[model samples]
Target: MSVTDILRLGPVMPVLVIDAVEHAVPLARALVAGGVRVLEVTLRTPVAFDAVRAIRAAVPDAVVGVGTLTRPDDVAAARAAGAAFGVSPGAYPALLAAAAQAGLPLLPGTMTPSDVMTVRAAGYTACKLFPAAQAGGVGMLKAMHGPFPDQLFCPTGGIDAASAPGFLALPNVACVGGSWLAPKALVQAGDWPAITALAQAASALRA
Candidate 1:
């Protein structure tokens, strides 16, 4: 499916940092129960691939993806682990080309108009606004929309429930990625119920 379709599948896409592979299944199950279907398993830990595999194998309906992708190998690695998509912190020509060649629906990160231009030139109309707050937040997104209203973005970083709504309310925003629902301590402690509740609350925070 397209990136926009995946974003529209749910209001909140949990950006997970899986340190333990064993927690993948339960965590995915909880998010699904709370009405979330798309998840981004960031490649930040040694067991990241294992967690992706576990989530894919155990949760039949979860639309699992990978995040923190920096290199071409990162896209390949995530694909091998069964990720449906891959998210990068920033955009690069080789990396974007590799992702398209690897058949990974990539949401490349961008922090400026030029970055967006490059990604758009590569046939990607959707992107992620990394460090959303520091990059000037909704105002930045609005500025971008003036020139490229067709482009869709999922702003990540420094985005909590409070600021998320403003981004989502924008016409150019497809969705918003955040860590508010899957706190590190909660995930590490195996507190799926709390995470599910958090996801529910976030889902309700629609634009």
Candidate 2:
């Protein structure tokens, strides 16, 4: 699916940083049960690829993806792991070029108008507004709408359940990415029910 379509899958996409590969299936199933199907498995852990592969194998309803991608090979690796899409923390020339040629639908990050324009020039209409809170949160998105009216965004970083609605309310935002739904403590404790409740609330957010 396209990046936009992936973002449109739900109101909130859980930004997962799974430490254990075994938690992948149960975690994905919990999130899906709570009505959030778009799951981003960040490549920040050693088991990330295995987590993605396991989730893809076990959770057919969840659209599993790779995040924190920074290299050309990462794209291929994620695709090989059965990731349906990919997300990068920031867009670099080489990484952007690689993603374009890698056949993986990517949501590259943008922190300014220039970054957005550059990615747009590379044929990306959708992007992630990384470090969104530090970058001015809703205000930045409002200003960006003036010049990049057609561009859509999925705001990530420094966002929680309390502030997600504000970002989602922006016209340019397709959705928001958050990690609050699947906290490390809860995941470590194997509290799938608690995680599911968080996912349910986040999924009910209005965009």
Candidate 3:
């Protein structure tokens, strides 16, 4: 799917950090059970690629994506691991080039107007607002809509269930990225039902 189509899959895309590859499939299943199909598994752990592979192999309904992409190699690696898309914390020359070369759909992150411009020049109308709260949250997005009316954002970082509706309410926001849906305590304890409940609530945030 295109990045825009992926963002429209659900109101909240869980930003997952999987430490154990074993939990990947079940975690993906739980989220999909709650009506969330787009998942962003961050490349913060040693088993990240393995987790992505496991999810892709086991979960046909989940559109698994790789997040926290910082290197040129990560783009190729993510595509090889079966990621449907990729997200980066920031947009850079090399990473952007690598994504184009590999033909990977990317949601490059941005925090400033200049970053948005750079991403736009690279042929992306959809992007992520990294560190959303620190970047002024709703206010920043509102300000940006005037200058970048054609752009849409998936604001990640420092967002939670309580604040997600506010972000989703914005016309410029396609969705929001957060970790609250798969709390570490819940995941570590194998509490898939609770995660599913969280996902259900998050999935309702937009509609």
Query: How many angstroms is residue 21 displaced in model 3 relative to the true structure, after the best TM-score fit?
Result: 0.6
Q: Model 3 TM-score?
A: 0.99
| Native-referenced Cα lDDT, model 1 | 0.90
Best candidate, lDDT: 3
- Output candidate 1 Cα RMSD: 1.0
lDDT of all predictions, in order shown?
0.90, 0.93, 0.96
List residue ranges in candidate 2 displaced over 4 A: none
Judged by whole-model lDDT over C-alpha atoms, candidate 3 comes out at 0.96
* Candidate 1 lDDT by residue in tens digits, 51-105: 9898888898999999999999999999898899999999999999999999999
How many clashes in each candidate?
0, 0, 0
Report residue 94 deviation for candidate 3 (angstroms): 1.2
**Error at 120, model 2, angstroms:** 0.3
Off by over 4 Å in 3: none
Q: Summing lDDT over every window of 10 consecutive residues in candidate 3, give the lowest-scoring window.
A: 198-207
